[model samples]
Target: MPINSFISLFGRSPIGPMQQHIAKAHECAANLVPFFEAVMAEDWVKVEQVQQEMARLEREADKLKKSVRLSLPKSLFLPVARTDLLELLSVQDKVANRAKDIAGLMLGRQMAIPQTLHAPMRAYVQRTVDASAQALKAMNELDELLEAGFGGREAALVERLVEELEDIEHDTDVMQIGVRQQLFKLEKDLAPVDVMFLYKIIEWIGDVADRAERVGNRLEQLLAR
Candidate 1:
């Protein structure tokens, strides 16, 4: 079947708007990899390039978010509550917003990643991105779950995906702690201002994953209802 026909059959699917948000959120999250890479390499040009790209993606996500919100009719009915769907959309948008914040800070400060903290910092970024990806995967299953009426095998599968997202988020938290410790060790050697911004950067990076986990948790709640 043509994809459009298939989509038309499920015209009321909330998954459509949710997936549009997720796609942009994932794009925002994925850009962080190259953003950090450029920062680590001390290549200001490349860093600016990636930062611009992140900003563009963020703008795109914001537009889609507005579109989704405005397009949702007050009388429209679905398998899930409208408020739950709105909450889920809000949480998903946060993921993209946090990514934009990270990129903006990196560009504004041009903060250098210390060699000792590089490995742990990169690990944190990767894990956080992984968590967001896992959350997206769970959101992707929403259509199937709705088709299954939120019961039986499909429900179980989505629950498992949520569990994996939580696990990855926990691991990112650990990675953040280790990275902070390494940063602490180098604090005395670095300028106070640089150290302060570096700490902020670390905190913001972790926020990305934190928000992603919230997305999963919100979805889990929706499933429970």
Candidate 2:
């Protein structure tokens, strides 16, 4: 390649595209709020509509991830380790994947949460989505981290944001416990198979939050390098 062409290719920062990908991931996760609502409303039309949109967003994120990987420079002159950036991208990808999984399984089964569990389950899903949102907020600072060479004030701000993400994850954990307890009390009245899936849905909600926190964890790791 010509020297000018090489410079232009390598000069393009990967940070912006990485941030775009996470925003899409979080958007998919955030849609779960409406998804669960439609399920509670027993509005199959709306539920299917929302799930298709989320699936679309996830696909868009996947395309961006692939583009980032292919265009990312392999040069040692990059600000962050190329491998570390790739790993972070992989973790970020899972947030969308997990969200897609929840939508697919729930929609496929036409699953319904018991009326009594609806309120808490909705709250649980919102908080879980909040985790993904927090991850995105922290990730938006990647350009600043690069500008500051990943240190000092910009780095401290990112650390604090990650800490907030951790706290949100903890709240989701407690909420999960409360939800499971409520479901346990009502399980006998519900179909045994439905109860089983309800428990799995609850666990999967927690997994969304868990994967979001890992995005924060990856940011912290990058700082350590």
Model-by-model lDDT, in order?
A: 0.85, 0.92
Q: Kindly list the per-residue Cα lDDT of model 1 for residues 1-225, writing each as its tens digit.
A: 433354466555556877988889888888899889888999999989988888888889888888888877664445677778888898988998888998888788888888888788888899999988998999998887877778899999999999999999999889888988898889889999999988888888888898889988987887888
- TM-score of each candidate structure, all chains considered together: 0.93, 0.94
Instruction: For candidate 2, write residues 61-145 as lDDT tens digits.
Output: 9999999999887863555788999999999999999999999999999998888888899889999999999999999998878
Q: Model 1, 72: alpha-carbon shift in Å? A: 0.6
Q: State model 2's lDDT.
A: 0.92
* Candidate 1 ranges with C-alpha deviation above 4 Å: 1-11
TM-score of 1: 0.93
Span of ten consecutive residues with least summed lDDT in model 1: 1-10
